[model samples]
Target: MKATVDPGRCQGHARCWDISPEVFDLDEEGHGTVLVAEVPAEHEEAALRAAQNCPERAITVA
Candidate 1:
């Protein structure tokens, strides 16, 4: 699976980082960054949760 974050929509809620810090990263300004564009088999669940948890709905997973 692949994940994308829309910078324009992100409000730096850090929900993704809270769900999976290894998969998501936060910049100094508190914006979220997708550390891995593609989710590994083991991390699929976490990635999905992170995306779902995004209050701004900035994360998209496919």
Candidate 2:
């Protein structure tokens, strides 16, 4: 799976980070950032959960 976070849509809620720290990170402003260009197989489920739980819906997983 692949995951990405849209800076423009992120609200810094950190839910993505909370859900999947291995795949997502927080910027200086506390917004969501993708830590990896490609999501790790072991973290795919967590990444998808993070995307689904993101209140801003800024996360994209494919």
Candidate 3:
């Protein structure tokens, strides 16, 4: 699965990072950023959870 974050929608809640720091990161301004877009099969679950935990619905997994 691949993960993506829409910066325009992110409010820097950091829920994504809280759920999966390995897959998600935050900029100095506290915006969600995707550290790894294409998640490995083993990490797909974590990645999906992070996406789901985003309060702003800024994260998308494909």
Candidate 4:
């Protein structure tokens, strides 16, 4: 799976990072950011969870 974060929609919630630090990271401003180009199988579930948990709905996983 692949994950991405829309900078325009992100509200610096950092929820994605809290849920899936392996798949998501935080920028200097604390907004969610995808750390990997492709999410590993072990981290896909967490990635999806992070996407769903994002208050701003700025995360995307596929």
lDDT of model number 1: 0.89
Task: Give the Cα lDDT of each candidate.
Answer: 0.89, 0.93, 0.88, 0.91
TM-score-best of 3 and 4: 4
Sort by lDDT, top down from the best: 2, 4, 1, 3
Clashing pairs in 1: none
- Summed backbone clashes in each candidate are 0, 0, 0, 0
Supply candidate 3's per-residue lDDT for 10.
98
The sequence of per-residue lDDT tens digits that candidate 2 reaches over residues 1-62 is 78988889999999999999999999899999999988989999999999999998999999
Predicted structure with the largest lDDT when compared to the true one? 2
Q: Model 1, 1-62: lDDT tens per residue?
A: 88888999999999999998878899899999989867888888998999988999999989
Query: What's the CA error at residue 17 for candidate 2, in Å?
Result: 0.4
The per-residue C-alpha lDDT of model 4 at residue 10 equals 99
In model 1, the worst 10-residue window by lDDT is: 34-43
Report the backbone clash tally of model 4: 0
Q: How does each model score on TM-score?
A: 0.92, 0.96, 0.91, 0.96
Residue 30, model 2, lDDT: 94
lDDT of 3 by residue, 1-62 (tens): 88899999999999988888888899999998988758888778988998888888999989
